[model samples]
Target: MNLDHLRVQIDSLDSEIVRLLNERINVVLEIGEEKKKAGAEVYVPSRERAVFDKIRSLNSGPLPDEAAHAIYREIMSAALALETEMKIAYLGPEATFTHQAARNKFGVSVDYIATSTIGEVFDCVQNRSADYGVVPVENSTEGAVTHTFDQFATTPLKICAEAYLPISLTLLSDQPSNEVNLIFSKQEVFGQCRSWLTANMPNVKLSPVESTTKAVKLALETPGAAAIASVMASDMYDVDVLAENIQDMQGNTTRFLIIGQEYSAPTGCDKTSIVFGVKHKVGALYDALSVFKTDNINMTKIESRPSRNKAWEYYFFVDIDGHVEQPEVKRALDELQEHCTLMTILGSYPKAEI
Candidate 1:
């Protein structure tokens, strides 16, 4: 085909694409109205998962699966904005990893509210100040985020969805590498990049701050100071990237939870989380766990935290491999409850694919 002929075809295809997108969004708006009348949630995680799965299956493509997913994410994000004034609260001052995770899941079209602490994120959702909240639950390198766990112990919020963000820490500052005398970042971030710092800037003093974004701000303002943060922070704060991929582990990822009023419905492949306090007796913990084995439910993770109300008493948080609505999972949890002083089903959410 001649160049002019091909150019005409490309322009025609682009026009068709725009028309189809608008048509799809019109249908989405009709569905949103029906949902509002029925008092149904606007953001349904199971439906979201099914849509993405279908998109991947249907794609034959010039575009990769990730690229397609990204495009659809923004499309759905725009639909969501039109359907409702959606607000996402995250643990941040912006450009933090939690903020990045929130944006990754919701895309750029929805509104975001940055709260300083995880507790505030929970509170925002609990009080209806935000439609949903994102909080980091655990990191592959740093273990559990205790603040998030502690909030789950008392809050009525449910985990509606989850996301995994691969963390790539960078050393950001305006100062030249040789002139830098101090480094600042969150304690967890410092831990993640400890080896890199020791090997590259051993003489520089390290200061732990409230958050990496906060550290970036301080770095921008303070003389002879650099901050270990995400590359996004470097751009947002206008600091030069001194070093990249500074985290000790190449596959370092943080798992974040989406908290809302209700848990997600079954998606076949899902995860259920619960917290319980065992009776203070021998074999009590073992008896509680044995219920899962009896019902043949797979438990993925377990972490214990001090109950705080009583000395030496603790509450165990567990993640199991099936939705709470599943027969086997329901039976196992029912039996497990018999061995606990207190038991609460935290939430059942679709497992993050990434």
Candidate 2:
């Protein structure tokens, strides 16, 4: 076809797309009204999942699934803003990995609050100051984030969703790599990029700051300085990415949890997290865990933290492969509760999108 003919066809398609999008928005606004009247959450993960699944099934495309998903993401994001002024709290100074993950899940249309600590993220959701909060729970390479685990012990917030952010730790600096003399990053980030620092900038002074965003800020202020941070930070902080993927290990991804008042209704494919303290005695831990095996449940993760008020007492945090509302999962929890001093079902949430 001639270029002018194709251009005319494209313009006509765009007109139809705009009209259809508006129609979709009007329907979404009606949904928002009903949700508000019923006091239900407007952003339903399972419904969104169904939409994406159906879209993928119907797709016979020159366009890829990821591209289609991105398009719908922004469409839903706009609908969400029209539906409600949802606020997301995250470990921040902005542009940090937690903030990035929050944006990934909640999208950019909603407002975000930057809390100084992971605890504050919990408090914001618990106190109803924020609709949801996001915090890093674990890293693939560095292991469990203890702070997030500890917060579950006291906080009533449930894990509404989970996000897995692949860490591509970059070196952000105003100065070139050769001119850089100092490096700053969060304590955890330093460990992730330890080998890279050892091999490349052995003589440079290493400093640990509160967050990667803070590191970028410091790097921007101080000449001859570099920061280990997300590539997103480089743009937000106006620093150059001196190097990309600097972590010694490959495939470093941090798992973050979305904290909110109530656990989401069961998505057929879901994961449940729980924390419990076993009565300190021989085989107590084993007996508690054995319930999963007996019920034919698959446990995905387990980590422990000191239970604080008592000496040598600990809380065992576990992630299992089914929703708490599921019959098999409920029965397993009932059997598991028999051996614990205290137990709490933290939350059941949709698994992170692959």
Candidate 1: regions farther than 4 A off: none
**Compared with the true structure, what per-residue lDDT tens digits does model 1 show for residues 209-277?**
999998998888899999999999988878899889999999999999999999999998999999999
- In the range 198-223, model 2's lDDT, one tens digit per residue, is 99999999989998988888888897
Report lDDT (CA) for all predictions.
0.94, 0.90
Tell me how far the alpha carbon of residue 89 in candidate 2 is from the true structure, in angstroms, after superposition.
0.6
- Model 1 lDDT-worst window of ten: 234-243
Q: RMSD to the native, candidate 2?
A: 1.1
**CA lDDT for candidate 2:** 0.90
Q: How far does residue 339 in candidate 1 sit from its true spot (Å)?
A: 0.7
Q: How accurate is candidate 1 locally (lDDT)?
A: 0.94
The segments of candidate 2 whose C-alpha lies over 4 angstroms from its true place after superposition are none
Most lDDT-accurate candidate:
1
